[model samples]
Target: MKLELLITRDAWQTQVAVLEDGLLVEFQQEPRHLDGLVGNLYLGRVSRVLPGMESAFVDVGLDRDGFLYEGDMGPLPDLADADGIEGKFRNPSIRDLKEGSGILVQVTKEPMGAKGARLSTQISLPGSYVIYLPFMEHVGVSRKISGGERARLKEIVRRLKARVSGGFIIRTAAEGVAEEDLALEMQGLLDQWALIRLRGQRAEPPAVLHQEADLVARLIREVLLRADGEVLTDDAEAAEQARDLLSSMGHPREKVHLWPGKPGSLFEHFRIQEEIDKALRARVWLRSGGCIVIQSTEALVAIDVNSGRFTGKRSLEETAFAINMEAVDEIVRQIRLRGLGGILVIDFIDMTKKAHREALFARLREALERDRAKSRILNISEFGLVEMTRKRSRRNLERVMTGVCPCCEGRGRLPAPWRTAQMIAETLSGRHAPKKAVVTASQEVVRFIEENRDRYAFPSGISFEAAETPRLSHFTIRPAS
Candidate 1:
C-alpha cells in the first residue's frame, strides 16, 4: 500500500507521521524529554490508595500522579473455589494496598492533559514481535495469526520460553517470522527488562528507570510492521538510521527509500500539508464532494454529515446513500487523524432503508479496522448516531503539533461581541420600548462597550451598556443587526 513515514526531531519535540498510500493516516508527537511509556515496565511505589473510589494514585516519576483503578488491575484468580481470595479480587479496592507497598507496574496509558498516567501492576515489556509479561506464565501467538501458523508459532515460543519465567504474547508482525528471529526478539526483550530492573534498584523514586525507544526505533518496532508499504524520511541522518534499523531486522533494503522531493520537507512532498490543512478545519470535504462538520468538547466529538454538491444519477435515496457511503470513509479517517480519543458520536444522515444502514456500518468498520489504535463501536443508534472511542497512547497529531489558541482558547471561531451590543443600543434607541430597557453581553464584550462609550461614532440618541448576558457568544451582535 506504499506506507510512508516522516521523522523530524527538533530540540523541543520529536514528530513522526505515518502515511498510507500517500495519505497521512496517523501521527505522534512527544516532547524531547517526557517520551511515551506505553509498554515499559517499572518497579514503583504506591503513593496513595483511596478505598472510597477503588482507585490508587501512583508516583512513577512523572509530573503528575498516575491513576490505577481496581478495574484496570489485571489477572484475578481464574478459579473461585481453590482460593477464597477469588471473590476478594472481583472488585478489589485500592485500599487493599497500603502506602509504601512496592509493586511491579507497566504503563498501559501515557500522561496527557490534566490526567495522570495510567499503569498496570502486571508488568509487560514488548519486543519487536513479542510482549514479555512477568505476571503470567504462558506462550501465545497474535490472534491475527491463525491455523497452522499459529501452531508453529506456539511451538517456537514454547521452545524459546523453555526456561523463561515470564509470559510472551507473539505479535502479529511475527507472522511468518523465522524461529531465529523470534528467539533474538525474546532475548532482546528479556535483556532490556533485566537492565531496567537493575536501574530501578539503583534509581530513586522520582527517577527514570527505563525510557522507551526514540521515534525512529519506535516506528520500526511498532509502526510500519507490514511489508506492503515504504518508509520515507527527509532528514538524511534519520533516513540512514531507519535504513540501518530496518535492514538489521531483515526488512528489504529497497523498501526503505529516501524521500526524493525537489523542495520542502517530506511531509510537504506527500501532500501531508494539504491533508493537515484539511484536518484543522471543522468542515471536512470528501472526495465525492460530500462533507462533515466536527465539533469537539471535553465530553465528546460530534460529527454531522452532509451531501454537499455530489449528486447521483438515480433516485433520492440512492443519492443520499452515495454521499453517506462516501462520508463513512472520511469519518473514519478524521477520527484517526484528529486522534480524537474518548466518546465520539457521529450523526450520519438517516437512511430509511435498512440495507443502506447495514452497508454504511460495514464500510465504517472495515475502514476503522486498519487503525492500530483500539476502538469499540457500541452500536449505531436508532437516531443514526455512531458511537465509538479510540485508544490514545501517545499525544495525538494535533496536540503534539499545536497548542490551544491564545485568542479563542481553542474555540476555533468567535463572533463580534462589542459590535453586537452597539448595534443593539442603536436599534433600541430608534425604537422606544417600555419605560426602561436593558442590554447585555459577555463580560469582555460588556467591558468593550463601556470602555468605548465615547469612542463609538454612533449617534448619542442610542445608549448601550454591557450586562451579564448568558447566551452571548463572544464578539457577536444581538437584536439581529
Candidate 2:
C-alpha cells in the first residue's frame, strides 16, 4: 500500500496526517503550548492518598492530578540503601502512602478528556530504537523481530542489559541496528534523563520537570517507524525532519518523499479530510454495497455491520459470510486508522457455521497483526459479536482532530430550544424566579429562543443575560412575572 504523511508545523501546533493509497487513514494535531506529555518521567509528590481506593493523587506539576494505583506503584523492596532510602519496593498497600511522600514516576499514558494521566513508577525512556528502563533490569526485544533477526536482537539486548545498570527494550527499528547506533542511543537516553533528573530535583510542585519530544519526533518514534510504510510530507521542513530521523535509524531515505502540491490544503491532496469525515459519521458504506456503523462512547467503540444494498451474490449463508468476511479486514484497518482503543465490540452479520466464524476471526487477527498498537481479540461469539481491545497511550485520532460538539456539548444532543424554553417556563410557571431570565446560546440556538420568548412564561424580575447569542452559546431562563 502507498503510505504518506503530511506535516504542517506552525508556531501554535503541528498537524500530521497518514494517508494510505492516497486516502487519509489518521490525523493528528498537537498544540505547541501543551505539546504531548506521554512517556515523560518526573519526580512527583504525593498530594493526596485515598486508602479506600488504594490509590494516591500525585502532583506532577500538571494542570490535573496524576493517578497512581496500587498496581502501578509496585513494591518497595526490603533491600534499602544505607540512607534508609528504598532501593526497591515491594507491593505495598494504599495505607503505606502518605501525603508529602517523594516518589519517582513516569507517564505511561497521557491525560484524555476529563481523565488525569495514568502513571507508573516503572520509568522507561526511548532512544531511536531502544527503550531505556532505568528502574528495570530485564532485556526484551520487539516481537516483530522474527526468525533469525529475533534471536540476534535478543542476544544484543541481553549483552547490553548485563553491562548497563537498567533495562532496555529493543524497538522494531532496532532490527539490523548497528552496535554504534545502539551505543549512541544509550548514551543519548542517559544524558537526556540525567538532565531531566537534575532539573526535576530543583523544581517546585506542579511544574514541568521534563518535556517529551516534539510532535514530529514523537510521531516518528511512535507511529512512523511502527507503521513500516512509506512516509510522505508536503512541508519542506517536515520532509527534512523525516529524512534525518529515518536515515539516522539505519533506514533508507528513499522511502521518505517530499510532496509538492498547492491544490487546496496539503492534506486534501491525499483525501485525508474526506476519510476523517467518514470516521466522524455514524455510518460508513463499503464498496461492495455493505455498510458499517461506528459509535464511540466513554468506554468503548461499537461497530455494527449491515449488508446494506449488498444482496448475497451467492446463497443466503454465502452472502452473509462473504459480507462479514469483507468487514473483518475493513474494521481492523479502521481501528488503526482511527487509533481506537480500549474495549471494541463489533456486530458482524451472523454466520450459521462455526468454521466460517473461525475463518473470519483468523482474517481479523491477520489484519490486526499489522497494527503497531498492541491489541488482543477475546473471541467472536455465536451472535457474531467480536470483542477486542487496542492499547492507547494518548488521545485517539478523533479527539486529536475535533473538539466536543457544540450543539450536544459533548452529550451528542441538545434539548430543542422550544422544549428548553418550556422547561424554563414550567420551573417559573408557579414559583417566582428572578425578574429577567437571560438565555445565552449559540448564534443558532439563541435565535430560536429569541423568536419564541413570549412562548415560555417569563417572570417580572427575570432578565436574560447579555443574550447576543454566544458564538457557541448557552442558555439562561428569565421568568417575567
Candidate 3:
C-alpha cells in the first residue's frame, strides 16, 4: 500500500491531506495563527469544582476553562499511599481540588463548540520512540507490539529506564529499534520534561509551559513515522524543514519531496479538490449504485444506507448483504475523512441472517482499525443498526469548512416568499392604514405580492408599493408619508 502526505501551504491556512493509493483518506486544516491545542502543557489554576459532575474547571489561558475529570487527577494512592497512607480511596473528590489550586496539566482533547478542552494532570511528553511519564516509575510496551518482541522490548526499557528519571511507554515505532537508540530517545523526552517542569514552576498560573511542534514537523514525527512512498509539499521552505527534521533524526530525508507542479496548485494537480467537494456533500454513492446519506446534528450523526439502482443477479438476501457491506467501507472512510465524532448511529439495509449482521459488524471494526483517533463500535442490533463513537479532539471537517447558513440560520430551510408577503400584509393591516405602504423584498417576491395584491385582502386605505431588495425571504413594511 502506497501512502503520501500532501502538504499545501497558503497565507490563510496550511492543509495536510493523507492520500492512500491516490484516494483522499484523511485531511487536516490548520490555520496559520491558531494551531491545535491537544498536546499543549499549561500551568493552570482550578477555577471551579463540580462534585456532582466529578470534574473541575481549570483556567488554562484559553477562551474557555479546561475540563479536568476525576480520573485525570491520576492515582491518589500513588500521590499519598506511596508515602505510606493505607486503605485510602485512590480517586479523590473534585471538591478537594479547590479554587486557586495551581496544577500542571496537559491538553488531551481540543475545545469543541461551547465546551472547553479536556486536560489531564498525569503529564506525558511524547517522543518518536517513547512517551515519558514524569510522575510514574515503570515501563510499558504498546499493546500493538505483541508476542516475544513485546517482552523483549519491555525488558530493554526496564534495563535502560534506570538511567532516566521517569517512566516510559515504548511506542509502536520502538518495536524493532536498538536499545541504545531507545535509551537516547527516552533521555531526550526526559530532558524535554525537565525543561517543562522548570517552566511550570517559574511561569504564572494559566501560562503555557510547553507548546507542541508545528504541523509539518509533528506529522513527520507522529503520524508519518514510516513514509512508505513520499511526503510531498508545495512550499519549498516547508519541504526543506521536513527534510532537515528527518535528516537530523537519522530518518531518510529522500522521502520528503517537493511537488513539481507549476501554474496549478498541488491539490489541483492531484484532483484532490474534487474529492474534497464530494466529502462535504450529504450523499455518497458507491461503485455498485448504493448510497449513504450522512446527516449531522448537534447530538449525533445518522447515516442511512440505500441500494439505489443496482439490482443483483441473485436473491434478495444476497443483494442486501452486498450493498450493506459496500456501505460499511464508505461509511468508515467518510467518518475518518470528515472527522465525524460523538455518537454515530448507522442504519444499514436490514438483513435477517444473524451471521450476515455479524460479518458486517466485524468488517466495520476491521476497516476502522486503521483510524488513528480512538473509537468504539457496538454490536449490530436486531434492527440492523450499528452505533459507535469516535474520539473528538478538535472540530470536525464539516464544522471547520462551513458555517451555519445565513439565510436559513442553520434550519436548512427558509420561509416561502408568499408566506413572508402575507405576514407583511397582516402587520400593515393591523396598524393604522397609511396612504401608501412600502414593502421591500427580493424582486421575485415583490412581483408575486403585486400580482397577488387582491388575494392578500390588504386594506383599501393602504396602497402597496413594492421595493426590490436582495433578501430571499425577508421584507419590511413602512408608511410612505
Q: Of the candidates shown, which would achieve the greatest TM-score relative to the real structure?
A: 3
- Poorest 10 consecutive residues of model 3 by lDDT? 78-87
- For every candidate structure, what is the RMSD over all alpha carbons to the true structure, in angstroms? 7.2, 5.1, 3.5
State how far residue 150 of model 3 sits from its true place (Å).
Answer: 1.8
Q: Candidate 2's C-alpha lDDT?
A: 0.74
> After superposing candidate 2, which stretches have Cα over 4 Å from the reference?
75-93, 405-407, 413-481
Q: How close is candidate 2 to the true structure, as a TM-score?
A: 0.82
Predicted structure 1: lDDT:
0.72
Question: Which stretches of model 3 miss by more than 4 angstroms?
Answer: 75-92, 163-166, 431-435, 443-455, 461-471
**Number of clashing residue pairs in every model?**
9, 37, 0
Model 2 C-alpha lDDT per residue in residues 1-481, reported as the tens digit of each score: 6655678766777788766666565677788687777877667778999988878889888878899888877544322133222255556676876699766677878888888898877667888788887666777888877898878877766775565566788888777777777878887887776666666556664556566787788777766676567666666777788888888877888877766665236666666677887877778888899999988998889999999999975687888888998887778768877878899999999889889888988999888876777898888887889888888877877787689865567787666666655655666665555545554444555566568777655655554444464323345654344
Model 1 Cα lDDT, one tens digit per residue, 37-108 = 776555567899988888888877677877888877765322212322222233345656779865456687
Per-model TM-score on C-alpha atoms: 0.80, 0.82, 0.90
How many angstroms is residue 3 displaced in model 2 relative to the true structure, after the best TM-score fit? 3.2
Clashing pairs in 3: none
